[model samples]
Target: LDNNKFVETRFGKQLKPSSKSTTYDDVAENYDGQYRFAPIQEAQVSRAMIKRYFETMYDRAISDVVIVGAGSAGLTCAYHLASTRPDLKITIIEANVAPGGGAWLGGQLMTPMVIRKPADRFLQEICVPYEDEGAYVVVKHAALFTSTLLSRVLAMPNVVMMNATAVEDLIIHEDHAGQQRVAGVVTNWTLVALNHDTQSCMDPNTITCPVVVSATGHDGPMGAFSAKRLVSAGLLKELGNMRGLDMNRSEPAIVNNTREVAPGLIMAGMELSEHDGKNRMGPTFGGMIGSGIKAAHEALRVLDS
Candidate 1:
């Protein structure tokens, strides 16, 4: 209670005032009252968000590439595709509220992510810091890599991410060559899709794209969704399903098998593992990264041809 001293709050912690006298009002003004943003009504906020999001959806109704699942492989594929061809419109549909998928955590919910040597080139390309461990590299926090990659991909003008949007089915059609192939995706709100058992029947919408990248993971709640749907649709004979974990074999197989499973439908990431009955690589992300890059190249090739 000294006459010359005044208590101030710094993030809920009390701090002794300096020689210069500071009043409660001064601290309050410096913190809470410093924001000069325009007052916005709740309705206006809703309108703004809806307007922007719907406009984006409408504009990207017909995209060059529609990547299902915004996991590591999908995001990386989008990043490379968008970076390489800014003219190409890319739409990434993610079922979860947040993107990044399992890349946000390493094996068994650990923080550090393991990336083998050659795949570390992608880390260097993205300028993400990592620790060298002989043949492998370690990202201090998995989130660092996922967030950095996500932010960079989303920053591209032609790239759009629709999280909380679930792709229910693939649209199959006959091409001019009389070949039946996946031509688009049927989508619905993730919440609606999740609550389908209790909710009334709601028709899903469709978005057509020349190329579709199925980067959904393996044996997850919604993993390998596109791949499984393709099998059900008769486009693919069957998904061999995923084999047990075997990093050495799985890692190489995943990258090697990243290719077009059906016309216009390219499988990447863990989806490739399940589609080809390959082994699971666990937390090692080298295969995922390599698969994404290869998928992007394949997509570019398809588009160019």
Candidate 2:
């Protein structure tokens, strides 16, 4: 698309790839460095990106699992699931341009991430270096840990990441036995979702899955969308929203309460706290990691059953 058309569709303007290629095959051939690079047509660059992205999307259009919100919990869940079950197709839908959610920034926009005792296992698994405090571990650069986690999860062959995409709603299904289940989710571009109030009637897309992992934390318009919407739609009982900050009480509560709330929907991360009305554990991440691990195990159990 041209700049204008791309802007209209994407809800923001971005540089369009030039159609013309100044150097189709030119390179510094004499350079013997291992990092030598070659030039190609700009159209090929766009084509490569489009081809891979569409292929992944098409393959995961009907996936085994769809994880909403590519936050710490969601990504960790995906990592564990993919590592355990290589045959299952998994997709993570993230509304933001970059994933990691709040983990990118520590408390008050700091760079250190604090993870309590056991949860540091996740960091160790991914080979992230952290300072070992007595009861807590501090990853000096929050971005480093998040980026490392993201990279490791994305490297999984069975996992596909749909970043900058929002989950508009859950696709609920009732079996012949009249048992209600969350079958999938309705999705749209993050830009479209953000401008939904002003945009034209734009139809969203669907992704079918046997199970869904809701890790969309406790803030933002779309956070807790699955669990909260379930209650609002009369599909589930009341979910007392998250309470005030109480790190000590909240951490354990979040981990213990992380489970499959409905037939096919599993709540993780801060979403669990919101669903169960647990205390909010500010910037600490032990509970989030524990919740993600539990959610992944739950999803695996559900799928195997």
Candidate 3:
């Protein structure tokens, strides 16, 4: 969640925690950061905060535990962490319009998920299937091996899911705690949707948590921007001086087997692709889960301190 990746859904598909309006993988690819710009008066991709950058976006005052993508990693992290510590408030902001991000096209659920349990297969290999009733093909990409275990985490009660919500910007402030140290994490999202009728924090509200868990993957809604910013600011020295799409940057699509990016502000996932039994042993899914969990744990550590 570390502010940008994915959360797993019950459909054996990824769900956007805060998104009932968008899909997880779709958001993953759509927000790939290279989705292209409209060239609004000479390609002016504002370096300003995301709130001032794009239109039709929304934000949820997501502090504490706010997951980004609502994919396997995010859901896993949320489930695992929540299982580890049920009291930690967790919120997922998904950009997809529905859960099971990729189960069916007309709302009629599929059987593979309920039958063969494809998630385990997704963790170990790329799945491709064709139907006799159509001329189309379905392809499921690979991810880290632990991805399948994401199931147990989803069933936990501590986990809350939100859909159709996309992150617009992150507000990182430095507040001092009794003159001991400085810290802060208040992320903003774009287009927050929830069930109507008089309810609790079911609407667009600001939530403050001592820790922020972002699971938005490599090319996450905010992770990509954050990485680019770090590079622009020269925080990632080991890779070199660059931003967005640079050789140093590791987008999920760049996975060529099992390579990974370094550990900077964004924990590189592609690095673990070498592990056996993994789908591709690259970053994206695995790195996202590992890094998101690490971020959550680290955030919790910071909170405890």
Highest-scoring model, TM-score: 1
- lDDT tens digits by residue: candidate 1, 127-165: 899999999999999999999999889877788999899
Candidate 1 segments whose C-alpha is farther than 4 A from its true place? 1-36, 176-178
lDDT of 3 by residue, 1-305 (tens): 35245565443335446645655665567767445534564334443434342321232243346654555445545654665677666666566654332222211332222112222233333223422223222223222222334444455545655556554434344435522111222233344332333445533434444444444433433333333433444434432222333222332322222221221122223222212112232222323434444545554555566
Each model's TM-score, in the order given? 0.87, 0.87, 0.42
| Reference-based TM-score, model 2 | 0.87
Worst 10 residues of 2 by lDDT: 5-14
Task: Give the range of the ten consecutive residues with the poorest summed lDDT in model 3.
Answer: 257-266
The residue-by-residue lDDT of candidate 2 on 1-305, one tens digit each, is: 54453322111233455577645233333554333667799999999999999988888989999999988889888888888888999999999988999889778989899999989888888889999998999999889888988887887768889989999999998899988899999999999988888967988999999999999999577788887888976877888888999999998888788888988999899988778888998999898889898999999989989
The reply for model 2, stretches above 4 Å from the true place, is: 1-37
Reference-based lDDT, each prediction: 0.88, 0.86, 0.39
